[model samples]
Target: MTHLLYGDRLHLRPCQIDDLDFLHKLWNDPDIRRFLFDDRIISREEAQSFVDLSIKSFKSGYGLWLFFERQSDLVAGFAGLLDFSQEAPSLIFGTNPLLWGRDYATEAASVVLRYAFDTLKRDRVIADVDEPNAASIRVLEKLGMSPARRTIVNERPLLYYEIRDRVGN
Candidate 1:
């Protein structure tokens, strides 16, 4: 059975193949696509590929999770530790634009980070945001992630951030 994760206001489950349509549409939303996929439209095939990867990653103890409002069951967003097998697993998250400023991103991400550091025994995680993505930068900062470095991706200025598991053994 797929595991479910919960936050104070959101409940999350491993994204399934059936969710590809929702994910594709959410990712392709003009307000959202710019912060991810280098602002390119996410094709259904690519979304399917990502769901496939999430399924595989679950076996290894980390992957993508789609979150929903606990009371209304409204599908809010997603959060996950991507590239888990790498030396530094990176964090990824997004919410419907209508849900912005509601702390859904932060709450969902907090659950993923706990799973990463506590359940997966990871030491640190990284995230990169387009320089203009102030909302995401704020979410990472609220999670106590600090600026690590800067780089360019697809000619877009990106700022990377990192957070170590301070509660490490």
Candidate 2:
């Protein structure tokens, strides 16, 4: 059976094909796409490929996880490690716009970070943020990640932050 992860107020499970609709809607939400996809709409097929990748990633000890509020059983967002084939996995997460400011992103991400470090035994993890996204910067900071570098993607400035597992835990 697939494992379930929990936080103080949320529960997370590996994403599956059945979640395609929810993911597509989340990815296409105007506020979300602006920061996550540079305002471009993700096609249904593209979203399906994402689920497919998650399935493969799970076999490798990491993948996307869908998180839901414990009380409501409502999907608040998604979080997971990405792009580890080429290098260390980078963190990625998003919360429902209506649920913004409640720190759901940070909450979900914190669980994923632990999975990466404590469970998967990764030495470090990183995240890429759009330069103008202060909220995400705050989320990464709250997770104890620090700026690693800066670059441009699609002509937009981007910031890369990283965190390493210290000697203890």
Candidate 3:
């Protein structure tokens, strides 16, 4: 069950229970969790639940997927269009801290965005970034996602960005 989303340097695949350890390690990294989990530590139980949910995303024909560098075979990170049980799906993305500043997020994001629009037939996709995550904001903007609004998410200020399918298809 190798689900692959190929990019120039990434091999995006469906995440599985076996990936809990990797998810735990990456999700707990201080640098990544700072912006990702709102600076809160995710217990193993929580990470397990998260993986379970991602696994379930397959039923909907869309969900989070883990990706690796095509040639290097190194874990690039996870990126996905999570419905998050909301009215509209949101873009969730990340890369290994060691790979930061390499446009991997931007590249992975673009791949997911196309999947959302072209394959999933979504008219738009959105991302919610913590106010202080300037880097994440930049990546969303680089993908042509515009700031849609701001609000209190999880008791913290967050900037919500949105990218609509230009052709209205």
Most lDDT-accurate candidate: 2
Candidate 1, residues 2-103, lDDT tens digits: the string is 668889999999998988999999999999998888778988999999999989988988788999999999999999988944569889999999988899
Residue 62 displacement in candidate 1 (angstroms): 1.1
lDDT of 2 by residue, 1-169 (tens): 4758999999999999999999999999998998998989999999999889988988887789999999999999999997844668989999999999899999999999988889888888989999998999999999999998999989999999999987535
RMSD of each: 1.3, 1.3, 1.5
What range of 10 consecutive residues in model 3 has the weakest lDDT sum?
A: 1-10
Over all chains combined, what TM-score does candidate 2 have?
Answer: 0.96
The local distance difference test score of each candidate is 0.90, 0.92, 0.86
Error of 3 at 15 (Å): 0.9
lDDT of 3 by residue, 1-169 (tens): 3446777878788888999999999999998999999888999999999888888877776677888888878888899987764667899999899999889888888988887788778898988899999999999999999998999988889999999999778
Can you give the TM-score per candidate against the true fold? 0.96, 0.96, 0.94
Cα deviation at 162, candidate 3, in Å, is 0.6
Give the count of colliding residue pairs in each prediction: 0, 0, 0
Total clashes in model 3, counting residue pairs 3 or more apart in sequence or in different chains: 0
Estimate the lDDT of model 1: 0.90
User: Candidate 1: where are CA atoms >4 Å away?
Assistant: none
Judging by TM-score, tell me the better candidate of 1 and 3: 1
